[model samples]
Target: MQLIKLCDFRQPFSLNDVGCGYGALLAFLAKRHRGAKVDYLGTDLSQAMIDQAKPSPRPSMRSQFVVTGDIPRVADYSVASGIFNVKLNQPTVRWTLFIQQTLAGMHAASRLGFAVNFLAPPGPDMQAIPELYRVSPDVWASHCERQFGAKVELIEGYGMREFTLLVRR
Candidate 1:
């Protein structure tokens, strides 16, 4: 939720949650921004995740979940959390391309802007994990600015060894 603070909740808005797992963000919004009207769409690559996200009795008119790698519709804002962290055994070049492509899709799907979080480089005391994709915020901030002409803000120091990029168009 902190990562998506760039979006204005004062007014009703639409949100696309990329790589959404079990619709956690939707649940968070229900608790934290209950008064704010939101049209939420949660998309994940895993069908199992989407199945779990569907409401038990009946689906809400305001929220929907789909299994897909791409956003199905444009929204006021798009957010991706923890999507860039686990690269597993994928090569750096392939993983970088994947990140770039995902960012591009998010930018295209968003009307106002988008937000995403990335794992920052491991500190001196923290051992770097080979399976995790970590880098300075500038790598993506620069990419968004150069590729999409976005006003990028790097948000850090939130008590986690990670950073969020608020990309506003």
Candidate 2:
């Protein structure tokens, strides 16, 4: 909440949730922004995930969404609540390109800010790390700032491991 307010994403704002696997954040934001009309859009490469996303309390609470395709070039705020760390079967170059391109999408769309979360990779003793990408926040931020030229302020350990980028407009 503080992050949202700090970024000034009150009601009537537009949020683009990239790689929205289950739309949890979308639903949560919809509920939070219910006081006012906010455009909550979720996009993902997988339709199964969207189908699996739990429904909002009401029809109105549901987040508007589309399957992977051409998305916003720029938006008020771009959210990757739990995306950006997915593992892929492509080569390292492809993986790097995918990350860069996705971030580019957020950069183009976000007018005020872009927020993402990459939980730290489990340790050797951990049982499982279900996520695809598991890079540290600082490493991710380095790549992000290098490409986007945005001033990066990293806030970690708020809940799980999260990365919020207050992109320069």
Candidate 3:
């Protein structure tokens, strides 16, 4: 939810929840932002995930869930959480390219801004996990600033070994 704080809730807005597993964000908004008007669209690549999300209690009549890897329409804001963490056996170069392209897509889909979280590099004492994709925050912050001409804000040290990039256009 902290990642979505980049959005303004004082008025009605539309949101695209990329990789919205089981529509968890919708439930969070339903409970926490009951008075705020939100038109929510949840997208995931897995059909089973969409099926799981469809039966969940909806926050509003405007909410919809779809099985897709891309955002279907422009929205006021877009958010992706824990989407870039697991790389499995994908090579670093390919994974990095995928992240860059996904970020570009998110920037294009969002009108106000977009936010995404990534795992931070492992501590010196901890053995690096090959399956987990982690990097210094500056790598993507610089990309958002230069590639999208966005005003990027890095949110970190919130009691997690991760950081979120809030890219505002």
Off by over 4 Å in 1: 54-61
lDDT of 1 by residue, 49-86 (tens): 88889542223228889999889999999999999999
Candidate 3 off by > 4 Å: 54-61
lDDT of 3 by residue, 4-78 (tens): 888898889999999999988988888787777888999999988888885325445279899999899999999
How many clashes would you count in candidate 3? Answer: 0
Candidate 2, 1-169: lDDT as tens digits? 3235325544466677777778877666656765544566778889898887765565444356677855654567777665555665556567767777877877888887676666576667766554366666677778777877787777755665445555554
| Candidate achieving the largest TM-score | 3
Clashing pairs in 3: none
Show the lowest summed lDDT stretch of 10 residues, model 1: 54-63
Q: List the residue pairs that clash in candidate 2.
A: 73-108, 73-109, 74-108, 74-109, 75-109, 85-133, 87-132
